[model samples]
Target: MGFNNWNSTHCRAEFNESMVKGIADTFVAQGLKDAGYTYVNIDDCWALPDRNASGDLVPDPARFPHGIKAVADYVHSKGLKFGLYSSAGTKTCDVQGFPGGLGHERQDAELWASWGVDYLKYDNCNNTGADAKQRYKAMGDALAAATRATGRPILYSICEWGSNQPWTWAQGVGNSWRTTGDISDNWSSMISIAHQNQSLAPYAGPGAWNDPDMLEVGNGGMTDTEYRTHFSLWSQMAAPLLIGSDLRTASPATLAILKNTEVIAVDQDPLGRQGTVVSDSGGLVVMSKPLADGGRSVTLTNETSSTRTVSTTVKDIGIGGASSYALKDLWSKATSTTTGAIGAPVPAHGTVMFRVTPGSPVPPPTGVNQLSDLPWTSAVGGWGPVERDRSNGEQAAGDGRPLTIGGVRYAKGLGTHAPSDIAYYLGGGCSALRVDVGVDDEAPNTGSVRFQIWRDGTLAADSGVRTAADPPVRLNADLKGATKLRLVVTDGGDGITYDHADWADARLACGSGPSAGTHELSDLAWESATNGWGPVEKDLSNAEQAAGDGTPLTINGTVYAKGLGTHAPSSVAYYLGGTCTSLTTRVGVDDEVTTKGSVDFQIWRDGTLAAESGTLTSADAAKALTADLTGALEVRLVVTDAGDGIDYDHADWAGPRLVCG
Candidate 1:
């Protein structure tokens, strides 16, 4: 729905005849149409800056040769619906280009109706804060009155970004309205949006829905596990299923998530009821929705940085009528039955969504006990911000750590001394809590702090008074029968001067957690990502094929790694290990049927290309290569996108190895 170089770089959506046709072609081929994801909507920046002499919005001459009607016809020919974009203001969001339909709402609506447009995504931008409801209603009225035999009624979508709280008042004004800001291809953005939408649960239903922006499933910013959570949450919220990435070159994981029928069914449920949170703890949240078939869709989310096991009983999820339920894992497509409590092992930034049907209840599964990462989302209560970098009494805590751990601030009382209390949730499964308590090495230490674990206001363990230099006092506490955990800090001898505190590496220990992944690159830190190249994926089996021909990428006489795509001429970077002498991997495009996607692998050490490989194409000629990383602190691999974007571009580094010195 977004096109790059159109009017904005938003969504990286590039508008062109080939790209548009490519999306349309893949949407049908991928079977997204039958899944209730039929509409192919294009976002802003489609039209030129000025309309024709008759004041009619026209497609860019260079982008659309056959014009808008032809494009609409092409979409219709594929048995799919078409959508377009416009602005409520005088000029659209793209200030540099694209004329807005401010005074020409009726004319623009009539024109789109004539062109057989089935949907319209009206955005609010550059308006200098005009009346949102009135302007949007004007367009909505015009669309309703447009008389076009060829065009079906346009499903109006309002993109006000929740400025006027459209969910509260835009019931009949539009089919769906964005309830939040734009979403990026990352975990924090996705989680933030999900949290924001929790309040608007009552606003979405069958005829109308809450728009949380677009999907970033295939986007490379987050891992597959996180993407699955993103998709599942969006589905649970009944948000629009707009694909924002290139479908033609989607990864296997992305395709699997997009084609999830059980999840999609929840979104398309006839009941049209949005799932609401049944139980919410720090990082653990359980959401449930009553389905049309007397079933329930439950999503147990561990929205944290480390792995955790979130558990809840069937009664807790409000399925009292059913003694037990047949539970199906929507992401894994695995089935199992559960009775009293359903405890699932959820990875960091991951979710375990289950479709529950009435059945005989079964006992809890083994290894159900789980540990937890740091609390990141708002579900985790009792946390605030402290300027750790501020230097007065003690502000010197600097390994140059990111301001937030797992995107959460651990400091409190920046300028004036203010004692604050923060608490973390303790699931019954937790055995103990572990964290480092300290004062900002550089901030003023006018206040002494106390750290204690509390069980319903009863003190279990306490660290009497800790100062900046004596911070990180190790403390152990019994979490058994602990219903709540607290970190209550008090001001020292001075009256609220400067009491910056830190809780570093805060986590809970339970029975079991996620094992160290077998991914070869998980231990290293990701660096830069070019427009074409993304962070290196670990142990991806898809990267083992030749680009043009479907064959394995063999270096010399050995085959290594499974799915590291070196099929494109793109550069990727990673932090070097302490004792790693050399790094080895195989590079070649997967053996698919395509041309111009041949890639070249160039290893760079400290910004210089240290090793090189010739153009490896679908010719099935792949060389197992190794680079001497020696004393290099950082290593970068530059792979060309085959001088093409991602057309048949499948570059992989299967079984990458690190040789210890």
Candidate 2:
């Protein structure tokens, strides 16, 4: 049903040759035949000299003494499968390296298949693009052809490392897709991989699965309990069980941990549903996946160093059965027909897997809805920035508008601002905060902005700016009930402005005042008498100056505006940027000072032009003429005159700075 490519890695020439020989020898010594680990996939650095003059993969003649064919025969003799590694791009990950597959896809695949290869782990290292799907498809086609050419049904393993969740398209290309980065041999590394795969279960099915790199079950830096948990979780998650430890010289404890058949059965269940987390305790978690005949497999893992009792009930498995179920401790062979579930003392970074059959009489959970489904409550008072709100005199949130919260200004510029530097001057008693931002496909440097969160002037979290839609970061802090929050945009610098910028949302956790989300931008007004170029005008009468209502102009329930320098020198100007469907610019007649100037109106959308206005010259007549900003959502108008002496009337807007649709 499923395959385990878990093996001990052998890199150097001597080690590689010896390890291959040892794997063949240990097959029976380790009692692997009785267990189900039949595939011993060699990771990187097993071949010699990389390739021949014709670009064919030439195994290191000495290391692969008899070549790959001999290795394959030896493995097959032990009734085990063999796998090889290569890159979708030209260079393989090995330090000595092989020819990158970029231009020679057909030749590489043909060579591997000719070597009697049973599996191919094609990784995506140097290749990237929206056209990545097509590139992977091309390689997949080559592999298929290679299979035909060599008359082998070689299993295709796409090792794009989950860059695009290849699971969505992996079946069409290969059997498994590594859904995370290369895993290290430690508890933290293993737990991290297990945690990240919880949401990817829906994409796994028969013949297709999420790969957590490889198994580190028997590797050092973890205890027997942790390794047990590692094996149990991989089995329950239906993950491709590729082991990455030294299998030949494994300790009795390590071999025993790797060959647990009970865990293997749960992994190889025909249903192929990936496990979902049922309960979590710090680093400990319980995950369950459905089995074929109304049964479920569960893994209880303690990612911490100390042993802890972790438990999960039947209802948490997403099943409301008819009064009973069978609980079988896969590792201990302890069977119990109970009403609810099992509680096991999991060792640090270790796990326990069990098979639960519905209608077998398990213990009933006493507290209904006890599984903490509260959707990760904003960590008490840790609400981050949010969309704008305009209730009291306030207009919109900070998504677009500029605010000097606590003294630090998180404006649209690429400069470093430490979270601890935010002053207490910001109106809201905001001790904690968040910024609502999304990645724009148009901004290449979006990755350039790094936001660092601080608590009481100490760094809490530092995030490299990312534009992905989900996983909006909500950094938390120990404010100690303090009444101030700070944000330091480490990369907002000169020459960078995101136009569709809007305050998506902000919030605050427990304190004497209202919660953080309560004091939104809707509570304040942006009534500047002067355009920061002069004092407040209180009354709107002069044509030389203009001020806004501090209140944000909202569209689609968000406050979108140009931050910093509301008034500019006409020809050279910038506006807050983001995704906008349209933009409009309108100026009041009383806001224009016409001596002799030309105004240029432009709107940027999707990082390209959606609209623009020809220079509107007002040399003589002019009080002002509104641009009627109806269609442009993110708009900017610059008025300037080439002749130095000719004074042109100022062109500006007063009612709403800019509205985004």
Q: Which candidate leads the pack in lDDT?
A: 1
Deviation from native of the Cα of residue 138 in model 1, angstroms: 0.6
Which candidate comes out best when scored by TM-score? 1
lDDT of 1 by residue, 1-661 (tens): 2211222235243566667777788878877766666877777767888899999998876777888888888988988888898888878776564787677889999999989888888888766677898899999888988844344689899999999999867878888999998888888998999989865665577878898888888878889899889888888887787887777788878888888888999888897767767667888988776677656788999998899999887655544333456888887889988765777899988999998786632211112111122331111111122223221222212222332222244442221122544444444444455455555554444545555556557776777766655636645566654545655555443433345555554434333222233335424435553424333344432333333223444433445545354435456665442234677766666554344456667788644577877767666666677788774445677776545456655666656655544
lDDT of 1 at 165: 90
Location of the lowest summed lDDT over 10 successive residues in candidate 1: 376-385
Runs off by more than 4 Å, candidate 2: 1-10, 48-50, 128-131, 305-307, 360-661
Tens digit of lDDT per residue, candidate 2, span 1-661? 2223233444554456557657756766777756766666666655554567776767776667777878877877877777777777657676666555776778777877776778877777665342557767777888889877767887777788778767666776778888898777777787788778765664577887888777776668777876787778778878877666666667889877778787777888886667766566587677767676557787877777788899877655544334667888888899887677667897766677788876632221211111112111011000111211311111112222342222233333211111112222112222333344332222333323345555545675665553323233444444444433344443333212321222223323221221222111112232111231322222232233445432332212222342222222332222222212222334322223333444444433212444444454443222222333332212333333323322432333323233333
What overall lDDT, based on C-alpha atoms, would model 1 receive against the true structure? Answer: 0.64
Per-residue error for 619 in candidate 2, Å, reads: 88
Q: Give me the runs in candidate 1 sitting further than 4 Å from their true place.
A: 1-14, 147-151, 360-661
Instruction: Report lDDT (Cα) of residue 215, candidate 1.
Output: 86
How does candidate 2 score on lDDT?
0.52
